[model samples]
Target: MSAALRIGMDIGGSKTAAVALDDAGTVVAATELGTVRGDDGVVDTAESAIVALATQTGVAPSGFASVGIGIPGQVDRGLGVVRNAYNIGVARLPLAQRLSARTGLAVSLDNDVTAAAIGAAHLMRLSGTVAYLNLGTGLSAGFVVDGVPLRGAHGVAGEIGHLAVDPRERPCPCGQRGCLETVASGSALRTYWPAGGDHPGRVLLSAIAAGDAEARAAYDALVAGAASCVRLLVLALDPHTVVIGGGLRLLGAPLVDGIRGELDLAAATSPFLTELELSARVQVLPADSSAAAVGAALAGNL
Candidate 1:
């Protein structure tokens, strides 16, 4: 008999990544494509990913054991619905139902950050509890205990970005002023330095090197806000390890180093913070890690 394989897809604002995992959970096939926007476009993108993976694996779409999607949004996993994912232009989507109907496979949905947390733990071979902070276009977090994800009562356990922390009182989409996201995310970068254009992170470090004062200030805020997030995670969950993931992590070593520096500087002030070893616990998600996609595949098994 053909091995029962699982297919996983991580649908982001700009790209959709998919993978076919063998029974042993190894990714045997993988592909990435530009994500189309809107409700129909989102469904089509996912369907295309599944087809591509099936073709690569020589398995018919319906032959796969299941399909799991990790996407940014307010996800109702039980009903397989997604809402308020503005980046991908999906206001509301019956994602699982539509995809399952089309492919004749059991479909499951997960919050993208949660899926990344699961994938990060498995991929990095970490033990005990783990907290994944996604420094993407927006900030959010995910939690895992041992290998199980904590989705919380309303599935918004890690929406810490919306927490108001800054006295600057910058407006956030969530109708709050001075929210952490307004200070820390990709979107915040645009607001902090409009001259850098829409995708500023691409050129931010270079601009800072060129003595762009605005860029430097913005970068400082991002680093500080992210460090604050790490501190927040420690205070709340005290996870053994905190893995940083998302589009922004692509900034690479500088970003990680800056966050660690911030943590260390704060720890210098208080013995309570020093004993926590916050800097030591922080880790950057590998650039090549297919954590979210792989995590989606694993999530389906649950």
Candidate 2:
């Protein structure tokens, strides 16, 4: 009989993806599926998604050595439980425990962003300190040193979205006021949008391209959020390179240029700051967001 394969599943606020990586780290098979919507459709959706994946690829659950799920929520890695996942309506759910029960296979769970970071570090072929930044419906950062994740004591170390932006601003879902996500995320862009634009990124970018004054102002705010994270990222981790991914990265060159400008302003303060200016040096590849699933699958296996 052939050796069983390792399965990686990346679950985000929007969708879920799975990849089968063999012993060599090469993806042998992969698939993506939408997240369960509405209040009453989660459990079956989650179960069927995997069952479908198994059917699609002929990867029967019993044939796989184990399954890893990378989730975009607070995870109690210790207990393999998802403390809370508002979008998915999961609370204190024993993801790994339950999956293991359902499939009768070893299951591993990890923060989606953490999995992405590990994938990024590996992609860049970096062996030392590395940081992975994910800009999904939410933003998160995770550190991997010598191939291990620093899953902070509270399991929230990478929760940069909740990082405060302005104490006087709007209340965040996390119950805090003026969270960085409030001023910077795709959601924030939608909220702060000036009245006359189509989709948020296009509206913002069109104005930025036209040098529209209001657009430029809003752009500054958005970039500021990223820069603030960048500075914090540098001061704390000093990673050789910070891999930036997520939906926001789709903006491409314009995004890179804007961020480089902010890093420059942040630099005048310290040369070390300038040294980390990765606008041009950093490997900002088209983010293969599926990597998170791969990392998740391999998390405990490694």
Candidate 3:
């Protein structure tokens, strides 16, 4: 018998990515497309990704046993309604039902981080507890203890991006001041950025390396911002290892060292830091990253 095939769709703020995997977890096909703006855009983009994957792989959408979606913004997976997707103005949209009707496949839906963490864990295929931090356009996290992503009491537990860090900083979409997103995200970098520049970490690190006092100052602030995040990670959610993903990770040592160095300075006695430092367990997001989309695709198996 031909093993069943599962289709996974990962929709983000600006693009849609999809993958088809056989029972063996081999990717049958992969495709990506641009965002379809507005409510109609959601359906258009989803249909496009679905059709592209189906057509390219010679796999009928109906032939798939399961389909999963990892979406930005709020989702009520129990009912398959996207409560409030800020990215594309998709509010209370019945995503699962809509897609299921179109593809004739059982659909699984979840937050992007939840999906990404799931995929990353599966890639590493680790046994113990693992946590994933997505440093995407914004910051978010998901935890998988023994291969299961914890959905929390309300199924919305890991909102690490919303962790408040600064007292005198800007507010967040969550109606709070000093959230981690305010300082550490690509969105935050736009505020103080010089136009036509490289990535924030690259520019900042360059400045520091070149002995630019301004760059040093910027680096100091970034380290402090990241320290605030690491400090909280130590106190609140102590995981075996923190997997850092997103464009910011391209900064490499500046990203890892800055966080660890500041964390050591602020949290002298943290077992979490001790464990990480001792084990060298910190892993950065690779240049060719696919964990998020893959995790979104595997949500049904979870």
Quick one: best lDDT, which candidate? 1
- Error (Å) of candidate 1 at residue 70 is 0.6
Over the stretch 40-121, how does candidate 2's per-residue lDDT look in tens digits?
3444455665676677668675677778888866787778888677777676677777777777778788888888777766
> Judged by TM-score, which candidate is best?
1
lDDT of each: 0.92, 0.71, 0.72
The model with the greater lDDT, 1 or 2, is: 1
| Candidate ordering by TM-score (highest first) | 1, 2, 3
TM-score of 2: 0.86
Native-to-model Cα distance after best TM-score fit, residue 275 in candidate 1, in Å: 0.4
Instruction: Note the clash tally of each candidate.
Output: 0, 0, 0
Q: Give me the runs in candidate 3 sitting further than 4 Å from their true place.
A: 1-3, 194-220, 267-279
Per-model TM against the reference: 0.97, 0.86, 0.86
Candidate 2 local Cα displacement, residue 79, angstroms: 1.9
TM-score of predicted structure 1: 0.97
- lDDT ranking, high to low: 1, 3, 2
